[model samples]
Structures are given as C-alpha cells and as structure tokens.
Target: MNRKDKIALERYRKRLEFARSSGEVNAFETKAEQKARIERAKKDYAYMCKEYFPHYATSEPADCHLKAAKQTMKNPTIKKFDEMPRGFGKSVMDDILIPFWLWINDQAHYMVLVTVSKDRASELLEDLRAEFEGNPKIIHDFGEQHGHGQWEKGFFITKSGFVAKALGAGQSVRGLRVKSRRPDYIVVDDLETKELIKNPKRQDEYVKWIERDLIPTMDGDIRRFVYANNRFAPVMIQTKLQEKHPEWVVNHIKAYDPVTYKPTWHQKYHDNYYRELEKDIGTLALEAEYLQNPQVEGYYFKPEHIQYGKMPKLNQFKIIIGTWDVAYAGSATSDYNAIDVKGLHDKNFWVIDTFVKRCKMVTAVSYMCDFQKRLPKTVVVHWRFEAQFWNDEVERVIRETERQYGIKLNILKIQVPKIKKMDRILTLHPYYQNGRIFYNEKLKSHNDTQVGIAQLLSIEPNYKTNDDYPDTQQTGIALLEPYNTQNDGLNYRQGKMRPKNERI
Candidate 1:
C-alpha cells in the first residue's frame, strides 16, 4: 500500500482497538486494585514502570536506573545530569517513567522533552503518547489521557491538563507556558551526537544554550531539569556541565565496572554475552558505549610515526621474537590477545606481522601454531608471553594446539617489568619518532595491523582503554634486547684515569 493508506490504516486500527479495549474489561484491573497500584507507583518509580510497561521494563531496575529515578523525583527543584551507559534504558527511565510518575502524582503540571533534534524529541513524545492513548493499564488507571492540545509534530497536552512539548537543541525555549503554569519539569535526552562532540565550539554552545535558555523556560520555585545521556566523548556537554556545575547531581554509572568487568545489571548481562558483543562491535566501541570510557586519542603517538615500507630480509635481522600479551578473561577484560612478530636490524624495529583479536585462548593459540607451520624449518621463532599469565588455561591451550598440529612451539614465559604500562608504551615513541620502525607495507591494510596501529597511536599517559597491541610490540622489542646492545670500542674518556692519581 501507499504511505498515506498505511498511515490511515494504522490510525483506523488504533481507533478500532481503542473501541475494543472496553470489551477487554476482564483484562482490566479493578478500580480499588488500580488505586492501590497507583499509591504504590507514587511511592516507587520502578514499580510503576514495570507494571505499566511490561514489554519495555523486562528486568528488575539496576541501581543506576533506580538512583536516577530517585534523584529526579525526590527534589522538585533538581538540576540533575545523569550519564548512564547506553542500552541501559536511560531514556525509558528519564524521559518516560519519571515524567509520567510526576504527572500521575500531580507534581508536574507542564513538562518539556528536549532531544538532539525536534524530530527525535517527537519520537520520544510518541512513546509517551502510546502509553497515554493505547496502554490499557494507563487507560484503566487514569481514565482517557489523549487531548487538550494539538498532538501535531512536537506538542501534546493530556485531557487531565498536563502540557508537554518536544524541542531540539539550540531552539528558542523562553517563555513557554500553559495557562500560568510554565514547564515545571524538563528532560533533555541524547542531546550530544558524535558530530556535535567533535566541534568544541558546538559543545560549548550546547552547554551555554542549556544554562542560558532552556532551563530558564521553566517556572516556579520547584522546577525539574534533567539531562540524561551516555557520554559519547571526553569533552561533550555533560563533561562541560560537570566542570562548571559540580553542585548539580551528577549520576555517572557505567554498564560494567572496567576493572572487575562486572555488569551493573547482573541479571541481564553476562560474560558470554559481553564476549560476543566485544567480538561483534570491537573493544574500542564497547569501552565507549558499554564501559563509559571513550577511546583516548594519541597525544604523544601520531599516525605519521608509523611508516609502511619494504621489509628487510629475514636473514638480515639480528633477532626475531613473536611476543604475546594475554589477558585472563576470554572476553570480559579490556584486553585483547596481541601477537606481534618483530625483527630488529641496524637500530630499526621491523613489525613483520600481527594477530590482534578479542577471542578465546584456543583461537589465538591456533593462529600461533598455524603461523609457525608457515615459516621455513631453517627459521626459528622464540615465542613469549608474560610469566604472570602463566596458568593452567594458557598451558592447556598451548598443549592442545601442540597435540593437534603434532608440532611443539618454542614458547617461553618472559618476566614482566616493574615499570608502568603507560611508561613502557611511551618508550616506543622515540623509535617511531626517529624513523626507525618499519611496518610491512603489504600488511598495511590488514585488519590486525590497522587495529594494532590505532592502539599504538592512541597511547598517552594514563590511557584507560585497550593497549595490548603496543604492549606486545614493546615486549617483542624487550625480547630482542640482547641484539640491541653495542660495544663501545676503547674510547679514552679514562685517559684521564692516570691523571686522577697525578692530580691527587
């Protein structure tokens, strides 16, 4: 069918369904039962959420969600900014449940929903509209809710005299009112996009807009201004607000603890699920979206530092080592298995190949074994990973691969240095800066190589995201340490050694 027909059909069906809803009287809860429910909902936001929208609020609310709800509801004059991990239903709680909760309790007479754009705001408004117009529980509890204003575009008013308007960022929002009751409750959701974060001027403009224009639109002594979004970058509006207004209630919560790799909502997220997600979306994205730590851009290390050129002959290399940086978790930690095969010649470190992936131990072990088989029998490779990661799991994977391939790898555990990771990764900067490191030009476009290079370039002091690639590369250089030393032939700075006794 055409677009108009489909839309008309949808509207007609909604009307028919609304007409049929009364016949589903058996499905509706009794007035007293609903009254009791409303009382309970007034007291607890989470309960109202699950009871009203069973389809959306599937699992028990996480502490972050509950905390956000409490913070939003407890203070009527709250100017709160919540930074929740994406996919954790920040919108459902901030935009819909809490606002509806206030309306139901007669706490808010006018509400405003602001998003990144007017269209986006309208979409969220539609969700609230769906609950009002079609939700049986809402209809049963609050009589009918749709009416009082044009539900066109981005404006709506319930029959019970609650006003709501959706607006985009940077739009004029001063002097908004509904019969002497201006917007007492305002929610700003997903106002920072990836593009907006890149422009510092734009980010500053947004923060300015919120502080100067949008928040001023609300009336009365008791006003609610909520800004909810998962921080997408280091210098977004949320961070700007955090710096300027430390007094505002800032509820910053990640989907999982970065150190323990524990999910905030333990009942919903698990290790296996995160593993698949890490594989599907990559570590950088997971760190940003799920872990609330966006990837750090390189300050010391630059892309130009990595030179792609012709590799020297293998026979010309003084020493070769295939270094591995292993993580304990199969998929949980912000660690990937990085296998960097490197060679040193004439003070230059040549990165021959790389195997970087967030995968099972068996997969990384299999790659090591396969790569070993491809090398000529004359070439000997010294395989090494950190001695700290020497465990039954790593041993079992290597032994099983040995059995499968009928070939033993000359793998050994290397002692980890007492130095910090950030310091060690930075040690490679001089080599890169001096034009002494050559990446195999043929592997320049390879996924593993590119990913490894990206990590290398992302190195800076106290970087929180993955660093396994550069860690392995630096370890490989350490392994070839013996090849790097030079003998200084008899330079006579001590020709004065005899002069010391003479001077005395």
Candidate 2:
C-alpha cells in the first residue's frame, strides 16, 4: 500500500523479466555447445576415474563393448544401448552411463528410470542411490537429496542446469507426469518378462500402454528408450517396434565368438538340455523351449493349417445332414458329443452348422426340432444318431418331433466299431491331409478340432487332451468315407441303409 513497497515490488518484477529474456542468465547452451561440453566432460571424468579407481576401471579394458557403451553415452544421437545377456556389464552400464551423463551435462533436465517389476525397479533405484552417495565426484557434479522408496528424488544443480529422478515401471509410474520438468532422458532397463512377452494380447496391451502413457510425457527431442532383456518371442517390444517403426535405430548386443560369430555358449547349453529333454519329450519340445520356435503340442489340432475349400454357395449345397456325438446324465466320465451338420455338394462338403450338447436326450431332440424350423424347405436335413446306448431315446424324440411338426425326419443308425485310439486317428488322417475336409471359421470347436487332427497325424500316438469328441469326430469321418471321392457319383450301397450295432 505504501509507495516505497510498490517501487521495490516493481523493481523485483523488472529484474525477473530481464532474467527470463536474457538466455545467457543460465549456462544452458545450444546443441553444438552442449556436444562440445559433453566431450570435454567425458575426457575429464574418464581421467578422474583412472586416477581414483585405477583397478576397478581397467578390469575389462580389453572388452570393446564396455568401451563402446562409454563412448555411446557421450554422443547425443545415441540415446539407448540394448545390452543383451547376463554378466555383460548391463548393471554397470546402468550405474555408470546414465548418472555420469547427467552429472557431466548440467543442462539435462529429468531422467525417468524403469524396470520390468516393482521389486527390480526398487532395487535399481537403490543401486543408483549407492553409486551417487559413494562417489564424492558424482555428489560434487550432482547435488544430493535423500528420501524413501517412491518419495525418493534427487537433482544435479550443474553450472548449466540439469536434474535426474529415479522411478519404476508400474501403475505407480503414472505419477511421472506430475513433475514440473519434462524428461530430457529416459532409461528403461529390462522392462519385459518371459510370460508377458510371449503372450500376444499381453504384449499388445503393454506396447500400447508404453506408447500412449509413457512416451508422450517425455521431451521427444532428447528422449531415450533404453531396454535390455533375454530374447522372448517375435511379439516382444523390441521385435515389434523394429517391425512397425523401421526408422528407429535398434541394435542387438549378443554374446558370440569374435571370429566365427557363432552362439557357442548358447548352443552348448541348448545341446546339453536337449539331449535329456528329447529322451523324455520330443524334438518339438526342444525346438519350442530352447530355440524359441512355435510348437504344436497338446493342441487338439493345428487350426492355422486348416484349408478353406472353394465350393458352391450355401443355397446350392441344400442337402444338409446332422450327426450327433451324444452324451447324457451329466456323468463326469461322459463325452460331451457334437452334432456336426454338413451340406452335401456335387464335389465338396460344406460344414454349414453344428450343435454340441451334453444333456438329456429329450433336450437334444427339442434343440434339433427348433433348428429344423429355421432351415430351407428344399434342404433335406437328415439326422444320424450313433446307434449305441442312447439310440432308442434319440429315436423316440425324433418320432415325436416329426409327428408334431409334420416334417418327415429321416433318422439313420450307424454302427461305430470299437477300435484302438491310434487306429481311429490313422483312419481320419488321409481325409484331412488330402484336403477333403473343411470346417466353418466361426466354429467354437475350431481349436479343439485342429488339435485332434494333429494328434491323429503325428507319427507317434500322443493323445494328451480329452479324446471323446475328437474320437467321435474320427468315427463320423469314417462313416462318411464311402461318400468321399473325386467323382460326383454317390455310392448307392454306402448311402442305401445305415449300419446296425454302432458300438465305440
């Protein structure tokens, strides 16, 4: 309110404005100046290291990778270095490169550190804390601050002006945006797990989260994304990014012989494990785990390999036939049968629809009656019941439904011979392999069907999953064998009458 107080306030405001306008007020220089400063700083720092910790610094002087990592930190363009494998100075690079770079360049604003899990992220922060505290030179370069866990924060008030903060990767990391300053640098240390990377859906989610949530918060111009992890799958962040964004520079630091560049250690370990693994499991198991290749095992069938045939439209293949693999009484040991419907064509078979039920026979018959109402008048949909324990029940329901609806439902009883599992698999292999079989893309049993087919096709009989439905599928294919041929002519004897005593 006084004139003297107002004058003092006005002077203070003018000085603040002057400081803001004059870029020279702070030592933060241009990119070219910063580069020159970084080079000089690195040379002085390396010399200081040699003088202070001669033994510790020169232990791995012969290693080109270690020297390269140190050099890479000096260059502004190379923001990340993906150090692969264990005992290859990964932790050392993290401890040294980031802190050293921040210490030397005062203009560096914020540093965001990330790891795969919360526990590992915490551990990395602790390691960084120790390095900063133990090294007095680091303290001199960067001012020290103490806090606990997530609350922990530090800064380096260099002549230029730079600050670094250690953080983890999780939902907790979402708080990185709260900072007044944007990150000039980011160091992501092994932010992927074996299970998370392998799964396609999980990998997609993580990648989107990183791009949407993490990347936007940083200073895009000076930002860095450092990552290191054991090779997982083709769907991993590194692999996916390299494919999706080809312009981004990516380097793979692998361990191999200098001359031959062969994976000696990796191969040796794989060879030893595979020798034992092959004896218990098979070659597919070895290839999947050790070689990191896709393996089709314990799968009901290989759906990826299923061929979609070029055939006439659904209206043309009007003659439909439904076959039921039935089970009733809700017994734990019972098979949940599938009623597979095929639309017979002049040349190829069209799997128009299917009905799978594991309940009372009356319930199943009612379902079939409902299905018949929706079908075309020209479409003569025939029902084939497995002439076994529940044949009489199916017959009774079919007769009642036909009488009620006035639709002449032709029910045929076919005898499914009792055969070994391997024999049944072998019988169905030729039909599938020769491309005589086709299934709807919308089939819920698509995966199961493929796995079943794979089991049948394997040289050694290895039926691991539930064999009931797949086995029933095999029997149905066998009964239809007489109907399958290159010639359009149907076998009169095969199509004449259904077999009796259908026993599995």
Candidate 3:
C-alpha cells in the first residue's frame, strides 16, 4: 500500500476504535433488525436521528424544533434559511445530522459546507467524517462509507458515491462537481462576522458570490439549500437573503420569548437558563445573539451626546422632580415601568436615579416607596405620571404600596398632551444636543442606567423601538423647565402658582 493508504488506514482505525468505545455504534442488532430499522428511518428522520445519536438526542423526547428542522431537511427540493439562535444545536444539526440523513437517503450526491473560513469548515466536517468512517450501526445498515480510501480534510468521497466538501466564504467556486453530479445539498453556516457587517462593500461582494457563483453550482432539480445563521446584524448575508427570498421557508426561532422569557426549546433549555445567560452577557448581547433582534447604535442620539459627571448635592439643585411612565403589561413586548429622577441645575438635566424594568405595577410602586425612604425626608421630590395611565388597578397598586410601606408618596398625575409619542420624546433633543444632559457618572455602569441609555440612543421617528426610559426622562426634564432658574426654593411644588409681585 502507498503512504497515503497507510495514513487513511490509521485514521479509520482510530475513528472506529473511538466510535465502538463511545457507544456511537450498536453492537447487538442483527442484520435483519438493522435493515428493518434503517428502512423505517428512511421515512422517520427524527427517529433515525434519535436512534443513531442517543447521546445528542438526550431530551428524553426531542424538542419540537429539532423534529421540525429534521422534517425541513427531509424535503429534497427545500430552499430554506434558518435564523436559529445560539445554543440551539445549529452546528450539530446542519453539519452532522442533516448530512448523514441525506447521504443515507440517497438525496445528495455531492454536499458542500461553506462557513466563515476553510479551517473552521474542515474542523466541523470532522464530525461527519467520524460518523462515516466508524459508526457501526450505519455500517451494519448500509455497509462501509470510506470509498476509494481518499479521505482528505478539505473534501471526502465515500464508497457509496457520496461526496462532501468544505469551503470558506468568498472562496473560488468555479468547478464544484463529482464524477458527473453537481452539489445537491449546500449548507452555508455563519458566513458573516462583526467586522464584515460593518463593511457594506464586503457584505455586498459576499452576497454576490453566494448568488452569482456558489448557489449556481447545484445542477440537479431535486436539491436543498440551507443557510443556517442568526441575523445578528442589519447587513448580514442571512438578512439580505431573507429580504430577497421572501418566498423561501424561514425558521427564525429565538431561544426564548423576549418578553416572557419562556424558553422556545423548553425540552432542552429552561427559563432560568436564559435569564442567567442574559445577566452574564447583558441584555443587548442577549437580544443580538439569542434573540436575533440586534439593536443598531443610535442614529439621532449619538454616543457623543451622552455626558456623565459627578452630580451636585441634592439640596443644591434648583428643582428635583421624578417622572414615571406607567405600563400595563410589564413585558418587553409592552412598555416597561420606566421612571427617571431628574434634577435641573445650571440648565443641565442630570439623571440622578432610574428604575427601568418589566415587572408588575406593584413592584414599581414598591420601588418608589423604597427610594422615597432612602432619601432625606428634608429634600422633597415631587413625582408625576401620565394621567392617561391612571386607572383603578393603578390606584389600588399605589394605595397597597403606601399601606405596605406605612408611608405616603408625594406623587400626582400629568396630563399628556394630544401629541405623537415620538414628538413628545423629541422634546429632549435640544438638551442632549447641547450637552445639557448628564448621566450620574457614579451610576454609569448600573444596569437600569445602561438600559435607559441604550433605549434613548436607539430611538427613531417611526420605528417601534423601546422608548419607555426616554419617555419618562423627557417628561421629567420638560417639567423642570420653569425650575431652570434657581429662584424657587427647595419647597417648590409641581402645580404651585408663583407669587405675583405686588406694587409696594
């Protein structure tokens, strides 16, 4: 045997050894049983996957998403894009499970996996290589897969005319074919990166390559195209494809409900898992990666507009007011209970404290009571919330909170004018633009403070982004306009009329 044959023999030996020892192959099934099982699995993809990969399909019964994805792959003529979130077993599903299914079903003659880089794709291809080289159950069912003993890292050909190749993004796609067949199954996994999304020219070029070059390499009428990646950026390849091919099947499954935090794949993951993950990575990252709803950096309220400094003493301010934006449903799908405590001094609006969260009205009310208790009773803070949100439930919540805390809250209602919400939000544009708004430098790293700022910067004219934090912020600052001058004492009230000067 040649040196290449010797190497192939050695690789196969090690792979088979691992597979047998690792419970990846069945040692008990007779030939008839294996044949019957494979034949039954030829139609039941999920069963086939579970039986073949008991360790991977360990959710007792697999999640609906896994079953659904398998059904999608079963279609020979499928053209689909899946914006699957992280931790959803995307790599394993596309690289190993689907490829094996296609090869066993004779649906693919030549398969191609195009990832961010050649090396990464080659590394991913190893999983499939191990399955083909060693899986005893597969070998018993369909015979040996190592065809012609030509197993290379870049591409591999099995004994049963199955061909699999790996390539990098923007790689040359001039000649991709088997002896007489073109690629029948193509998987494009994570071709966009953070830096790549920032460069529109490169993004455009990559899309062109996929459309004008790579995809056209498929020759058969019966084929499948799966682009599996989260749409974490505005100009990513997956986003472009989704816009261009609205007719294609799109499975944009998120890890959990962004509002309720209920796990989508509950069989595999739990609610606390997503909550803990969000805490570790922060809300913005959770939205971008696991939710696939990335927030673009502020266009109107740029980062430069945000200023932070050491705040003056609470008593030194001309006026300190608190604004509350009440929300009925305390989920991200609805408005949050956004409250911003603002103090106007020297014509600058300083964010002293913030309470932004998606919780029940009682929780926000309790927070107000707690904050009131923490402050010096000598320094009074007049609080106001929109009159439109005032209802029996709101009143009951306030009364209950007051009773529970055994203290009265100095709060009132502010009639929101009949103007557009966005119009009202734009009231703070001048302050932000003129560098008259300052965040408490000490509280800059606070989660509530950061979330409020993120929402402020993400505001757009007509787009429905989260505006709860900024809504309350503008309301508080706008209310403190008359108090910009330091003539009023610390006792100035919200609706207290100014004492008219009398002729002496």
Candidate 4:
C-alpha cells in the first residue's frame, strides 16, 4: 500500500478499537459515525507524536554531518558521533538529531539533551522549535499546532511515544527521569566549568551524578553524546564513562580542527595571535591559555627572592625559636602538618629547614629528635609546638620524646585568632618583600605548596583547600613578626665570638 493508504488504514483500526472500548458503537453503527471515529483517531495519534517527538520535525539525517556518520543501526543499541567546532551547527545537533530519528521511525524513544547551564538547554530547545515551525514538510506531515509550553516548549504525541526533555549541569539535571522503558539518547554538552574542571570535589560530584542518576536510565539501546572543551580535570564525567564503558564509541574534536579533518583557517589565525602574544606578554600567559600548560611555579613569589646565601659563623643574634604545626595523623583524607624552624642569624630571621610529614605522633616525635641532633649545640633554643589540635596521647608522646632526648620543648597553648585562610598567607607577604624572611631550597618539594600559597594570596577570601603547609608557614611568620620589634634594642650576644682583630 502507498504511504497515504497505510496511514488511513492505521487510523481506521485505531478508531474501531477506541469505539469498541468506549461502548459507543454497536454492530449496526451508521456510516457517518464510523467516519467520524476514524478522523478522531487520526487526530489523536498526530497530537501524541507532536507533543513527545517534536524533534522529529526539526531533526533530519541530512541536516547534521555528525548524525549522517552514525545513521546505520546494526544493534540500534549504541549511537555515537563527534563534531568539531563550527558555527552554530553544534546547537542544531543538540536541538534536532534524536527527535527527527524517532519521528521517522515512529518508535517509543526517550531523549535527554544536557549542557553546562539551564539557559543553554532552553536555548537549544527554542532553536529546535523555530526549525520545526519554519519547516513546511514537518507542518504538512505532523500538523502545525502540535507543540506546547510557553516557557519550556516540547512536542508531544499520544501514541507514537514521548520526547522527555533537556537539562543542564547541577541538581536540575540529576532529577530528570522518564517512566518509559529506556532513554533513546542522552546528550551531555560542555557540562564542566573552568573552576569545576580544576576542582577535585566538583569533578567527583559530576561523576557521581552520572553513575547514580545517568547510567541507571540507559537500556540495551542507548545513544549518548558528549561534547565539551578539553579542560584538565583529574576525572571528568566524560573521561570516567569512557573508561567504564569501553564499547562506547568516543569522538574528540579540538577547537582548531576543520570540519573536513584538516586544520581550519581559524586555527591558523589563533596560531598567529598566540605567536604575537608570546612575543608581547612573554611565555607564561601564552602557555597557560593557548597550549593549556601549567603556569610556572614561583612566578608570583620566587623562592630566590627570599634566600639568604650564607650567614656569619658567629652568633650575633639573641633569640632563637623553632615552631611546629603538628598533625594528628597521616591519611589519604587529610593533609600532613608542616613545621618550620626559624632563628635569628646575623640579625636576620632565617627559616633554615622545614619538616613535613603525614605520620603518627610517635613517628613525628622521632623525626624531630633526629632533626635536633643536627642543630648547633649553642644556638639551639626553645622548640615551640602548636598544641591546639594535638590530642592528649600525642602530647604525652611528644613530652616523653623530648625528656628522653634531653631537649627543651615549649608547647604553646595560644589560640590563633580566626581569620580567612588566604588572608593568613598574605600576612607573610610584607616580610617576604622586605627581605626579613628567607626559605630554604627544600620548600619547593612539598606538593602544591607554592600553588596553595599563591592561591591563598590571590584567591577570594572564601576559597578553601587542603592547604595545611601554607597555613603552618603563615603561623610561624605571624609569631616571628613581633620578634623584629622586641629584639630591636637588645645587645647582640656574640657567642663563640670571632676575634675582630683576627681579620686585621
């Protein structure tokens, strides 16, 4: 039968079934009644398709180059495509691809389109509506008045199936669900932000949403789309899903790649701009933006700027203090504590050595004992430990170790005034700038220590992280800041005094 004939027959069968269920028809029904029933059935079927499968009107195979690449269906269980950066074609893919497929196939299909924000999702849907309304073929085939929702427009049909909705990142996307069998397509487009991509916590949250909410909604037949800018996240949702489901066909398109797989003219333009930027701004900013390389460490605060090459052999300063920021215990969940030993050498304060460890209290005490053995016998003064978070057991262990080793340990029970973490780091900047403070070369070895320090100085006040080392360093600096004033007039104790006349 021809397409029109098949449509008419299907409409008649639906009407007859409805009439039987409704008890509105007898074996002696009039010809006019039978005709009206068929017309109503046809209209109902058209309405159902319009509501749930509006994308069918906008999305056609010929419109998207990426969709054309994956038109064949051996399993219909998997669908995948990768499209490079073009104009607004990516938005077209988001709006139309799955809806068009479902419309022509006339199957019960579920679709989800996700982006980085709700506004983006709505924008795509609006574009889809515009495309559908403008297409004469779709209006002629599916009828013009088939869509709904003034704020959130969607096409629905009563019988053929339902087209669920689109969503963006966050809690809004997590709540999307369909009562239907399985979603026909799930599209995630640029779901991560720059800050979130750099954050481990946010990245993990995104992954959890996929595993808990997204994966359960899939069935034997699933079409998934992931489109995003390549940012360096430890484990993004796209990366995690690809790892878990190896059968998934993955496609990656860099911003620079042409539609035809060669480098685009825009890429060449970007290259030229980057070269000019490199010449003008130097290497640091160019590498960060264009090449996506990690910024050079110590660019903002160079270690050498605060380095004191060598101090006088003779002790000319009176006060000597070593401060400890003790850690409770070492675990993967928490950061290790940092201890900085500072002393006045030749009237200048120097941070000679730093101790960093993620160890039990006894192990840390033993490490400190070993450290004490290397210090100059006469210059060694008070070893101050911050006892704020130190439990009784750890404190006892520390006391026992100091007594056994014959070392004088001063446990400072002072409560630090609460301030923003980053603000505490900035408090040390003045000393660093004025050459009153110096750090040993070993400061760089602590993981992300400098980054945390820079972030503490530059980031907004509310920013937080596992930044114990920088905090410890700041505490020591705060304690020492007053010493510069207290010891201003004190006579320099020339211990083991080198003969002034010996130089002559």
Question: Using TM-score as the measure, which candidate wins?
Answer: 3
CA shift of 53, model 2, Å? 7.0
lDDT assessment of candidate 3: 0.78
In the range 134-157, model 2's lDDT, one tens digit per residue, is 444344333443233233323232
lDDT by residue for model 1 (125-184), tens: 766766677777777778888784555546878888878788888998764776677889
lDDT of 3 by residue, 7-60 (tens): 756865675565544354558768788778888777776787777766566664
Q: What's the TM for model 4?
A: 0.40
Clashes in each model (backbone N, CA, C under 3 Å)? 0, 13, 1, 14
Q: At residue 321, what lDDT does model 1 achieve?
A: 87
The runs of at least 3 residues in candidate 2 whose Cα sits more than 4 Å from the true structure, single-residue gaps closed, are: 1-41, 44-58, 61-83, 137-179, 258-504
Among all candidates shown, the one with the greatest lDDT? 3
The full ranking of all candidates by lDDT, starting with the best, is 3, 1, 2, 4
TM-score to true structure, per model: 0.71, 0.41, 0.85, 0.40
User: What's the true lDDT of residue 320 in model 3?
Assistant: 84
Q: Indicate the worst ten consecutive residues by lDDT in candidate 1.
A: 487-496
Error of 2 at 170 (Å): 4.9
Q: Write one digit per residue (lDDT tens) for candidate 4, span 137-245.
A: 3443445633443223332322334455656665444334445455656666667666665677777777777667765566654544444334233346566666767
Q: In angstroms, how far off is 62's CA in candidate 4?
A: 43
Report clash pairs, candidate 1: none
Model 3 worst lDDT window (10 residues): 490-499
The count of backbone overlaps in candidate 3 is 1
